[model samples]
Target: MPATIPFKRSEMKRLAEFAKREGVRAEIEVNGFVFRVAPDFNPVRVAVTEESDLDHALAEFDRKHGYS
Candidate 1:
């Protein structure tokens, strides 16, 4: 919930956890969506008032060309 910065390995891990607690979770990327791996854990469908998220951007070079 602050300024942006470079994506660090540690930050990614923590971000993933924070998302889990907030009831928004994902397994990995498939298309532009994060697919879920777990079966039991699920969140309710609702909107948020706060504004903060892990801005995960796709690799420019990879997107332009083909497979990464």
Candidate 2:
């Protein structure tokens, strides 16, 4: 069995415009000491806070699975 996924150009454009208006430009800031890191699209940066959070989550997941 298969399902069809429709791609609407107009819808995409509208969504992009909306994102731009909402300041949805791809960006990340990873300053270890800074709390206000702007987002990046080209060669985006990953904020330290985000990385730390993800690291903690992964550690917890691994621990649950008895991963050393």
Candidate 3:
């Protein structure tokens, strides 16, 4: 099941600014219609811990996905 959140139009600006700064997507529903605000283009970053097994797994994934 999905959660139903109550939204107010007064918070649009704050939400937009937050989304832009954090590079996230925000959705708003009004009158049964949905509107989305997406941040500017930003590349995704992957973080790996300093572990041999995790490093090997990430390398294997990159090789399998042609990202190496």
Candidate 4:
């Protein structure tokens, strides 16, 4: 089994508000584990590539595995 951590809706709202107000990171520690909380400043966007890139990647995979 895996360990899980849960937060109440009110706690999540308060944390978000605190982060927004302070404009800094907020951290929480539980059972000796520490976590840093912050809003995603620059979320990664999926890149769109040409179809040739996919063909090349598939060819490379096939070559590496000797797939005929």
Candidate 2 regions exceeding 4 Å error are 1-41
Which digits, one per residue and each the tens of the lDDT, describe model 1 over residues 1-68?
95443445575677577666776654555345443422347567544432222122345555677856
Q: Check candidate 3 and list the clashing pairs.
A: none
TM per candidate: 0.28, 0.39, 0.40, 0.43
lDDT tens digits, residue span 1-68, model 4: 97776555577678877886787789777787665667657766655675678888999999999996
Ranking by lDDT: 3, 4, 2, 1
* Residue-level lDDT tens digits of model 2 in 8-66: 45655665666666766533223332122223347769999999999999999999999
Off by over 4 Å in 4: 6-9, 42-68
RMSD of each: 21.8, 16.6, 10.7, 7.2
Superposed by TM-score, candidate 1 places the C-alpha of residue 30 at a distance from the truth, in angstroms, of: 18
Misplaced by over 4 Å in model 3 are 1-10, 42-68
> What 10-residue stretch in candidate 3 is worst by lDDT?
42-51
- Full-model lDDT, candidate 2: 0.60
Candidate 1 vs candidate 3, lDDT winner: 3
Residue 61 C-alpha lDDT in model 3: 97
